[model samples]
Target: MDVVRRNNVTVTGNPDGPVVVLAHGFGCDQNMWRLTVPALAPDHRVVLFDYVGSGRAEPSAFSEERYASLDGYAQDVVEVCQALDLRDAVFVGHSVSAMIGVLAADAAPERIGALVMVAPSPRYIDDDAYRGGFTASDIDELLESLESNYLGWSAAMAPVIMGNADRPELGEELENSFCATDPEMARVFARTTFLSDSRDDLKKVRVPTLVLECNDDVIAPREVGAFVHDAIAGSTLVTLEATGHCPHLSAPAATNAAITEFLAALR
Candidate 1:
């Protein structure tokens, strides 16, 4: 068995309750769930952490080639659960991390009791039957933006991450939270998030799952969320009437309520 040493894990809330591991999206890290922690803390034992390359993770672990696919990130999630000795945990993930959680849950279904996938996308690219919300040109443009001005693109994309561009201050704060990684590392992480497709793993998720989709998200739109719901057998899909890719920040109340309700139902 491979032992993955604990990286930058931020745990909070009840220590004795059922474990709830929260994973953040691309460009952002554990801090993105700050608003969510307070809500889940009173009842659930929440565990949050940065990927090996992002947030406050040990930068030495980041390798563009190694983490080029989703499996690399999934490995980190599995290692985290094993290191913490968490069992039957509720794995919550946002944006790209949502897909990571799915992959992790598939890898270790025994450890994960349920999956709360927020704004998850199994595949970002479009195929004949699937609409991943982003066109090939759109992704190319985003990659070009990353290449042109890494910092600027991060700033520009911050609103999309938080789902509120009118609040430039929020975007700035998100950009700061995501600024922990170097430009090269950020590029690597970005490529991994945007390129990998986890659609095939949806059918393999054995645990009970809930796919929460934001109302009007450009990144993972409603259709994609529905696709996930249909693909993942026995999983329920709920739409949060909020805009943006990061609902945990934009609509904490609704997000928390949905999570609470779902967890209660499982009990």
Candidate 2:
């Protein structure tokens, strides 16, 4: 299958500029990055794509077995980079995609040079001395509720995940994005996202990295941000004044500024 068509890859901006790939999180498509695209387009080659099971990606390309682990998503990133022949591209990943970027960068180090993680959490379930903002039972219940009724779970959780209750539309948009996804696929993605642990993977990131986190994100708390920063050597962590897991959507201006500043430093 053509990787571009399979992933619904979209490329734009200055072709000669350094490449920057924008990856969205679970339940979100490339459209989620609409607010941030323009900011980078003038100076970077921007690449956007939907994962096999999300957005407008070819549904037939989705395999539960293949996507059962984060490696599958990392493969998608690697293949997309290969298809574009991108060299030393900077990867900007949101939510779960941040860890996926880590895996992809490790898998294909030559293809990715730097990383920008937006509202990332290496683990969602708390362990001793580490607070990932959720307990094992909490995750189990969340997943069970989602498996039972994905739509209802989405409607209830989207608001909490997006935060910014003052902006009902953002929550509604997230809910719609969740609803648009295939329930079975979303369930698999959800399980893979919440249950997986990537703390050990952080040590593999040798490139320049910028970790962006929200001031108040229910999904990934400040402790999680500090954890990621401390885990990765020589990484910069910026706490946006935003109050949501999806800061690129809730606070695009701040998110974009931080990302652009990071990109400038990279260049």
Candidate 3:
């Protein structure tokens, strides 16, 4: 398969510089990294791609069964890196893509230099010993909400997920991003994101990792970030004041700075 066109891969910045791959979370494409990409592109090789069924990717590449699990998405990450011949690249993933990075790095450890997880959670559903910030019932309710008004769910839930009551535009932006995705694809991605468990994968990460935790993310709580930090050996945890699940959109400056600082240390 032509991985480039398969995922709508785009590359920018100095060809000789270290590579940085930005993976957008569910409900969004690579456009979500617009604010942060420019900052990294000047000094690093920036790679951006839309997962199959996302952005302008070839729709034929999206297989329902393949995408039913995140390992498929992880495979996409590795293939993108392989096609581009990327090595020792910094993989920055938002929300669920963060876990996707984990899986990708585990599969091809040498390709990834480090990982930066923004508002990530291995499991969205809470367990008796773990507080993932959402219960199984809550996940069902969330699916129910999305199904009840599949079209409107994105617009309505954006504000709640963003957590910036004072900033209406931020929520509006997220709502737009969410609603712009293909509905059926969005549904499957959401299910894979919330229902899957990747807790054990954390312990297997060999590359340096950073977990960025927002203060008031309704989806991934501070505790969940801490748990990821603890589970991944020697992982750095940075608490941000972004107050949203999508900090790359709501607080790009701080998010960018945190990522910059982490990448600099690897240099």
Give the top-scoring candidate (lDDT).
2
What would the per-residue lDDT of candidate 1 be over residues 1-267, giving only the tens digit for each residue?
333334587778988778899998887778888888888898889988888777778887777877888888888889888888989999999888888888888888877889999999988889888999887888889988987788888878877767777767777777886665678877877888887778888888888899999989988888899999999899999999888887787788999989989988887
Candidate number that wins on TM-score, 1 or 3: 3
What TM-score fits each model? 0.94, 0.99, 0.97
Give the local distance difference test score of model 3. 0.91
> By TM-score, who's the top model here?
2
Q: How well does candidate 1 match the true structure in TM-score terms?
A: 0.94
Rank by TM-score, highest first.
Answer: 2, 3, 1
Clashing pairs in 2: none
Q: Which 10-residue span in candidate 1 carries the lowest summed lDDT?
A: 1-10
Question: Local distance difference test, per candidate?
Answer: 0.84, 0.97, 0.91
User: What is candidate 2's lDDT per residue for 65-147, written digit by digit as tens?
Assistant: 99999999999999999999999999999999999999999999999999999999999999999999999999999999999
The segments of candidate 3 whose C-alpha lies over 4 angstroms from its true place after superposition are none
In candidate 2, how many Å is residue 177 off?
0.2
